[model samples]
Structures are given as C-alpha cells and as structure tokens.
Target: MEPSKSEDIYKETKTAKVDDSHEFNEAEVKRLSNYLSTRVIEIVVGVSHKRTFYIHEGLLCYASEKFKIQLRGYFKEAQTGKIPDCQEDPELFAVFADFLYHDGWLRKRKSLYYSCEWVMVSRCYAMGERLGSKVFQRECLWKLQHSITLKKFTIANDALCRILKATTELPERTTGNEDPLRALVLRYAAGQISTLRKDPAFKELLDEHPELGCQILMRVTDDESDCQPSGAPPEKRFEDKVEFL
Candidate 1:
C-alpha cells in the first residue's frame, strides 16, 4: 500500500534533515583529516632541559603566519622539520600549543590579580605578538581585562612593570606604535595612579620606562574620570577600558 500524504511529507522532511547533518559531519571530518594528514614538526622550546612539542604543520601554520612562512618557505626550519632554538619559556609554549589545539587557554583555576598567573599571561601576550598570532594576543588581553574589571583585581606594581617591559620589547614598540596590551596597562595605571605612586617599585617602574610615565600623565590629564582609588570599581565601563580589544 502507498503511504499517506502526511507520512510522505514527514519522511521527506526527515530525509532532508539527515542529509544536511551528513554534509556538516563530512565537512568537519575533512577539516580534521587535513590537519592530521599534515607533517608533524618538532618545536624545541627553552634553553635548559628543552621541552619539545610535536605539532602538525598545518595547525601551526594556520595559527601563525610566521610559522607558515618559516616552515613552508626555503628556511632552515623547513629542511630540518624542527625549530630547535625557540627561546620562549616551555610553560608558555605549552599554553600556546594548547590554544592551537583547543582554541582557549587551559588553566587549572581562575587566577587572582596578584598571582604569578598574571605575569604568565603577560609573557604569553608578548610571545603571541612575536609569533604574529593576533588571536592569542587578543585572548590574553581579554583575560587580563576581565580579571581586572569584573573580578576587581588590581595589578601589582611588579606585575605591571613586567608587562610594560615585555610589551615595550615587541617589534611594534620599536616602530613607536603602542600595542593594545601596552595601552591597556597605561590606562589601568592612570586610573589607579594615586595608589600606585605610594609604592617604591612603581616609582622605579616610571624611571625604567619613562615613556610609560608620559603616557600615563597624558591619560590622567585627558580623562581625570579614569582615576579611581586602588581596588575600587573602575569608573568607566569595561568596554571603555579595552577599546582596542
């Protein structure tokens, strides 16, 4: 017996949905297969007791154009299938590798403002900048800003100085351009200058990075509203704090 019209309609609809789902699955499988089929390269990080990471070339190149060119072009790294002299910290490189595979930073727990995790994230930001990975840099900045504003986490003077110094060494800084991380630091410092000034380390930071002093001064002069007491809620909205992001 022939099926009823309603039954035929339902069957057609279910078949179409199944076909669409199959197509989506096929696309995902193809993407995964491409990544897996690519050659694996050894990434040697750190100086002493160097930690090595075996990564697919396609995934690494997809995340960083610098690596793409270095590995694909006629560079020594391509011939050896290994990057033997990466100077970045092994722990930080682990974060980068995790991000490449997972699309997010892997942390055991949310870090406090004054924790060493802050410095780690800052270093990761600098490393991301060097690697030409904007996505990694953006995620790091977002994490920093989120902790500062929403968690009401105040950056320690030492951490601030470390971040400032790291950002200052980036290639963009040599070109006299203020990167987003540097700008965010200056903004936060300007907002909490009165409290930061009491710390001797803060004074030393200004001495070491005179340009930071000038920028903070300019920010304070331009927007006195950003000058909030230390540990107080930010005067500006979170969005205003990280306009670059």
Candidate 2:
C-alpha cells in the first residue's frame, strides 16, 4: 500500500528540529552579547597609564581563571565586588576583552597590521600565562599560528625586543612542558633571520640575553647535529635542545 499524499505533505513540513545547543542562535547570541557588553564590573590595569575597564563579571570570570577564582571565591574582592589593582597592562587587557566576548580580535579591526597585532597578542599570551588562563593562552597560540604570515618582518624595535625578552625568561620544568610562546618566537625569528640580524636592537637583545642566540640557531637548523654545541652529553642533549629552542 502507498503512503497517503496528506502523510507525505506532513512529513515534508515537519522539518528536523535543530540542535541549537552547539549552533549559534542569533537572537540568543545577541541577548548574551548585550549582557556581556553591559559592563558591570570595573578592572583597573596598568601603572603609568592606569586604565580602568568596565566589563561584565560573567564574561570575564568565564574567560579567565584568575578572574573566576578572584571574583567568585572566598576573597575580599568577592564580597566587595570590585577588582582593584589588577597589575595588568590595559592595552593587553583590551585585546583579552575582545577575545572574551568575540572569541577573537580579528573582527574588530579590518586594516590592523600584523606587526601591531602580534605585539598585542604576545602581551596577551604573557598575561594568560601569568593569570593561569589555559583558554586564553591556547587562543593566543591559535591566533598567532593562523594570523602570522611570512612578510618582511616589520615588528617595531621595542616590540621585537620585548618578544625576545619574554621568550627567554620562561622557566623550564620537567620534560616538554616549557612555555609554548618561546617556541613560537624562535620560529618567527628564524623566519626573519636576515632582517633580525641587521637590526641593532636585535644585536643588543642577543648581547643582553645570549640564550636567545642559541634559540635562533636551534630554530634555523632543523637537524640537532647542526645546533649541537661540541661535546654536549647524550643525556643532556634533549634538555639543552629544548633549553635553547
């Protein structure tokens, strides 16, 4: 027996109900976005140029582990409902705020140059590392990997110095758990070896932080033998390899 025309029409009209749990619903997204943008809490960041940011507690706490614990835990700030003297750079935090709300900073600026943006991103990664925000840290890595392209390597002297300084200072623990940012910087510097070598600031950076030179060498040469300092012990080889690179 054939199915009725009425039954076929009913089946056609009964479209599959979407699983909005994973999908973005415009109305719901708009409502939540508005809430996040309302700015209920004040965060004071920076030293010389102290900047106070008005942000939503929910959005902030959700994105940052430091804020989540500080705002919600049994702390004085929790009772007072005020985040004071955060000691973060306002400029860096601004980029972080963009990430928290929009999941990225790319949408905010259309004509922003990579040199300018990567500096901000490097700072954000530093902030994330300090705050123990794995989410923000991961996002920073993703953004850098996706956005950074091989060009003439036009980062400002100050920014390049800062990046070099930041990468060198990261502490080493047990095996592979080093600061990932350090590796990213090494790769970047390797790609721009020619330009970076000519820069006086970069030379000064190497003089100040000699380990960065090793990192550059390690990244430039793919083979361990090429980077290996003479007579380095077998056991210490991997440790030294990661130490520089």
lDDT of each: 0.65, 0.60
Residue 122 of model 2 has an lDDT of: 72
- Candidate 1 lDDT over 100-157, as tens digits, reads 6653442212434565777888889888866767767766776766566554666777
The TM-score of predicted model 2 comes to: 0.66
Q: Report the number of clashing residue pairs per model.
A: 0, 0
lDDT of 1: 0.65
Q: Model 1, 119: alpha-carbon shift in Å?
A: 1.6
Off by over 4 Å in 1: 1-33, 106-114, 173-177, 221-245
Q: How well does each candidate superpose onto the true structure, as a TM-score?
A: 0.71, 0.66
